[model samples]
Target chain A: MIEFRHVSKIYGKVKALDDVTFTVGAGSVTGFLGPNGAGKSTALRILVGLARPSSGSATVLGLPYAETACPGLRVGTLLDAGAQHPGRTGREVLTLGAMTLGLPRTRVGEVLDLVGLTERESRRTFGGYSLGMRQRLGIAHALLGAPEVLVLDEPANGLDPQGIRWMRRLLRDLAEAGCAVLLSSHLLHEVEQVADHIVMIGRGRVLAQGTADELSRGRGLEETFLELTAHTDRSPGATASPGAGAGRGSA
Target chain B: MTRAGHHLNDIAGAAPSPITKDEKMNADTPIPFRRLLAVEARKLVDTRSGKIIAVVMVALVVASVVARGAVVGPKLQTLVGTAGIALGTLLPVLGILTVTGEWAHRTALTTFVLEPRRHRVLAAKCLPPLLAAVALSLFAIVVAVPATAVVSEVRNMAANWEVQPLGLLGWTGGNVLVAAAGLALGALLLNAPAAIVINFSTPVLWAVVGRLGSAGAALAEWLDLNTTATPLMRGDMTWSEGARLAASVVFWIVIPMAAGLVRVLREEVT
Candidate 1:
């Protein structure tokens, strides 16, 4: 279970997230849809305690993630698949995660297999792995703990069609097994195919959230998504709120 | 049913899962300090930079000791002191990499996610290099013991086996302090190249400053760890020397480390 209540993040007058609120229940998949700079990553970072919220709170399993002892054991996160040390082999990355979580080293092989990485691929350093391989390694790391909650950002990036399909099934299986899954992605079709509930955000505001059919209505998912976010300013210098430049000096 | 049990009946097949009945029971338990230490220790030599620097440390220590034995004819104190000086100079670089590697390599996200009480993680990061200082000192002494004997016999010189315990302690302590200074700088800057540059260049800068006559020499005495550490390496110190050493330690190690710790604890990892 993950909850974001009125979470707002300001980075030197850039309101990355503004009064954002959402809840992800166990045994379900929530697709966090947003354009670039829509604050999806910031919100997810705040959820996992990587970034602090300027106002409001983000909690996982009834408490802030940092307060939860051994959080990696309970919540699997893949904020950046490429964030692993480049020199470490894929297996070594998983092994380190296993070691950190007090899991048996044998689990490394299992997750590698589950993510479709071969033995040779696993032994290669992460730097040499393709972007697809990096995504697989990151997925293996996230699944290393068999977490009760999963937070993945753009997990489908660099994945092939088959790999995307595999991820869809894996996520569905995890949610069916009672894991709460929060996935953020730019792929509308992938999100529609897998996510049970969709939370569409534009310009740091949640525009709409419901089941695919509920939100799509007469229009298709892509068209509905476009309509909802059509007016959002995607400019690099755009501000999220009025009077945003007022506190620029202090920010 | 256990998550692993669920996995057995799922599409993923009857593979071994990360969680089991036993693990689930202890899932919420805090990671023990020893586990963190073990992982941190492994991380020290696991990267290209960490491994290269570590290998360089060993080679330099051995080379310095053996070269000293050749030039000075196997005096235990001198050879061991050579090893100490070599380690003292290089270990700080190793320490800097160990702390900054998390940020440089972007593994801080993974590390902090796993262990969120960042102070504990920082403490764990600091210990492995210091421990290496102790372990490698023993290693240097191990090499020195045989080098002293072999060189003494080859050159037909009486071996001076006598070593001052205070000097050895001072040597080891000095290595630890300098290494801590490196760790502190790494934490303060959180950039490998930048921190390593500052670590090496600061002493040279201080050397230049110390050459500016009595005022400069006095400032170096009170503030430069390199200058204060000389008496420490030689096992010769008065109460005044000890006080001066304390002052330099505060100036070099404590203040930067405290500021670095605060920054690290409060800084966002993005």
Candidate 2:
């Protein structure tokens, strides 16, 4: 299980997340919805222990991630598709992940096959892959440890229809097998199709949370999402919260 | 597997094979520190840039030896010292890359996410290049062997087979020390270009600035790394000289490394 209990992340004077609390229970999928600067990425990064929430704890399986023993065994994260070194082969990337997770080396090929990357593609350097391929490799790394919780950010952003379908099945299967899966996405339709629960946030605060049917209220998810986020930020296009792009690089 | 869907009616639709117990979580063990070291070592030669650095390091060491052998007639001390200078400069670059490469390539997120304890990760990052530097030190001496022989045969130079173990240890130790300093610099800076720039420029800049007057000389005596390290090559420092060397290393390497560890632990990875 994954949880954020009264979490707030502040960068300088700006609050990226404000007292946000949510739970992603095992055997289910939770879709996190937010605007560009709404702190979806910030939340995911905190849950995975890449970024510490300034005022609260993000816990996995009841322990704060940093304090958890063998965190990789309980949590898998794909926060950045471009985070793998471009010069390393796809297999090497997964191998390093496997090594860190204390999994058997053979798990490398298993993940590559699970993600539908051919042998050649797996052997090729990551720099040669397209964005879609990188996303797939990122997913493969996330699955390397067979973690109990999967935290992914925009995982299907660059996938083809077939790849997306495969991802849907994989996520559903994992959740069915009692894994907790939380995803943050800009693809509203895909989130609608795959998420068992939905949490919508605006300006670092949760605006609404429930199932898609609950948030819909007879209007489609896209329309409702637009209406909810339309006036959330007063400045209209203020996407640069201090920590907005920090998930990719450090100061 | 009895799959769950959004609708209650879909729960009993069909079944597939379950994910086996072995495929479930392996939560009993965290990756060992030695394993982390091994993985970091593997990374040093895994990428194109790492390969280039390794190759370039070796080539430079050999070229330095060849230049000494061809010009100064391959005296063992001169040859080893030349290799030490060349390898000393390049090995630190490798060490810096070992830490900064993670941030430069944006791979720090994946790495830290997998192993969240930042200290263990940093410790692991320090091992590989230092180990390689030791190996490279031995390689340079070995290569100097053949060069010394060739020089004795052609240039009528006496082959100084009398080797001082303490001096050899000092040279190897000195090289490893510089590389660790590079690693600390990398961890402190986190940015590759910035870390590298500071790593190369700090000594040269201090060397120039440390020669202006008595005050500058005193500062250099206690704070200049290049001078403090000379006693290490000779392995014959007095207690006062040793204290001075310790002070310089603390100011340069230890402080940056401790600060960098904190920054790596606290800095947000986006």
Top lDDT prediction, candidate number: 1
Cα-based RMSD of candidate 1: 4.7
Residues forming the 10-long window of minimal summed lDDT in candidate 1 chain A:
A242-251
Which parts of model 1 have CA positions greater than 4 angstroms off? A236-251, B1-18, B212-214
lDDT of 1 at B126: 97
Q: What lDDT does candidate 2 reach at residue A176? A: 79
> For residues B9-50, what per-residue lDDT tens digits would candidate 1 score against the true structure?
553432323365666556779998888888998887776766
Question: What lDDT tens digits, residue by residue, belong to model 1 across residues A12-74?
Answer: 978888999999999999999877668899999899998899999999999999999889878
| Interface C-alpha RMSD per candidate, 1 decimal | 3.0, 5.3
Tell me how far candidate 2 lies from the true structure as C-alpha RMSD in angstroms.
5.1
* Best candidate (score: DockQ): 1
Off by over 4 Å in 2: A234-251, B2-26
lDDT digits (tens) for residues A1-251 of candidate 2: 88899999999999989999999999999988766678899988888888888898889999888777677767888998987788899999988877776667777777777787899999899989998999999988887666778999989888999988978877887787788999997567778889999998888998889999989989767666766666664453533432332222111
lDDT of 2 by residue, B141-201 (tens): 9998898888888888788766677888888888888888888888899988988888788
